[model samples]
Target: MRTITLCSGKGGVGKTLLATSLGRIIQRQEKCNVLLVDLDLSVRGLTLLAFQNKYELDRLPFSLTDYFYLEDEDQPALLHDLHKGLAQNNSNAEESQETTAQATAGPSPYERLDGLFILPSSTESERPDWTPLHHLELNETIDKLGKLYEFATSSLHVDYVIFDTQAGLGSLSLAATTLSDMNLIVLEEDDISWRTALNALMEISALNKRLQQKSHSYFLANKVSSSMLDTADKLKAFSFLPPIPFDAWVQKLFAHATTAVLEKDFEQSDFFKQVESRVWQELAVILGARQRTTGNGPRSSWWRG
Candidate 1:
């Protein structure tokens, strides 16, 4: 399975939203199973958005947090439990005599959309204890995450694994980068965002060089305005995806909507249209979901030094 990670130097750049929306789009277009993994243990943004129902969130049998702390021998059992729990919940939901409105509202956060599944970061009611993660060595964390990736791709039979990683160059984010086939470094037009994004790019480049891996990394300018497009294009020596323009409607919708992508209005919004039309096409090419002609093949390798 192909892997992609949406990472940023700081929070609030819309990584979780992009991850979820991209998974839905890919699943719908490719007719394949796509897993959306929340690797951001600190805030659990994707978890909150995906598991809108508190009952379901509390009922989750396992999460990335639990997987990280468990012994290697026991990891497989947790994954099995997770699969069983999801299957049982989905089966029960299907049998309910709920109204058509409720039924058509959209898939439950567990399986938010058909062929789209989410792996939450944690199931804890309160703040998760991150002390355990802090103690693990960097390589150890990557090894554990690699095993999780293998289970999702091989056993779960998912075609793609998209990670919504914690902001910044933290251990988990770095590890996710190492495992990803492509890393989308999302940023805005602000000074801090630009500087931090540059730092993040350098870190990823250094990491790839040290490991002798050629994982592609690209810049994605989100919430851009007409005036910002010129500035975004001025970034030196980095490949860029089509910029997703700022949308006032979406900004207001996020205030009340549990998950924007599931909302009917979002489908009509420019942000959604741009992602569906522009961003995914570029991503499909980079992820090998689509073929690149000989003339354009070198574009994929431009990310490397």
Candidate 2:
């Protein structure tokens, strides 16, 4: 499975929204299993972005909060609860009913986005009350999470597992990105944002070399204007996701509380169509989904399970 982590060193750059849209796009286009895991504990806002009307989170049997917020001794039991909520099991009666689609996805964690799942870190972030990271054992939390991540992806048999991370390059974010096959960074078109993002990019590159592992990373300049695309182009010449203008429709989806991301035909918009063709095309290349077909009409999803 290909694991891609979407993170930003600075906030308010629309990385969360991009992750949400890509999840939808992947599900729609590829027709394969996809999981969007929310790792941003401090701000579990992406949950709202994905499931605006389905905000009955309080009634759910379990959530990611239990695994992270609970004490270490109590974590084992909580982890089981997390698993049930994420992947299918006999204990959960809903899993069987959820398998309306045939031959491929038995059941997934999402509703409309067929074969796509979302594992939110929590309905609410309990960051302040939680224990701070122990510097000496900084890798403990992320390493544990990485193992769980591996298990979850393997069991689900998904085509991709996308992680949306917390703001800044903390141990967990840094660790997760290193573990991921591709690290996607998002930033706005401001001097401070650009400079800070560049520093973090350099840090990640250095970290990859230190770990003696090659990492594939790309910087996506969010909220870019046509005029500023030139500036963004010059910022990262050697490596990046070709920066696109800030998608107005995408921004509209996140800013409004009542907006239904699924209801609208965003592809009709010139901006959305361009991204679907270009940005997502590049993304497919990174995911290794693009293959030169024998007939050469278009790439096929014949290999997806």
Q: Taking the tens digit of each residue's C-alpha lDDT, what string does model 1 give over 41-117?
A: 87888998887777778877789889887888898789766655444434332232332223333343457777788
After TM-score superposition, the amount by which residue 266's alpha carbon in candidate 1 deviates from its true location, in angstroms, is 1.9
lDDT of each: 0.78, 0.64
Once fitted onto the true fold, the runs of candidate 1 whose alpha carbons sit more than 4 angstroms away are 71-76, 83-109, 128-132, 230-237, 292-298
Could you tell me which residue pairs clash in candidate 1? none
lDDT of 1: 0.78
Q: Return the top candidate by lDDT.
A: 1
Residue 97, candidate 1: Cα error in Å is: 32
Q: Candidate 1 versus the native: TM-score? A: 0.85
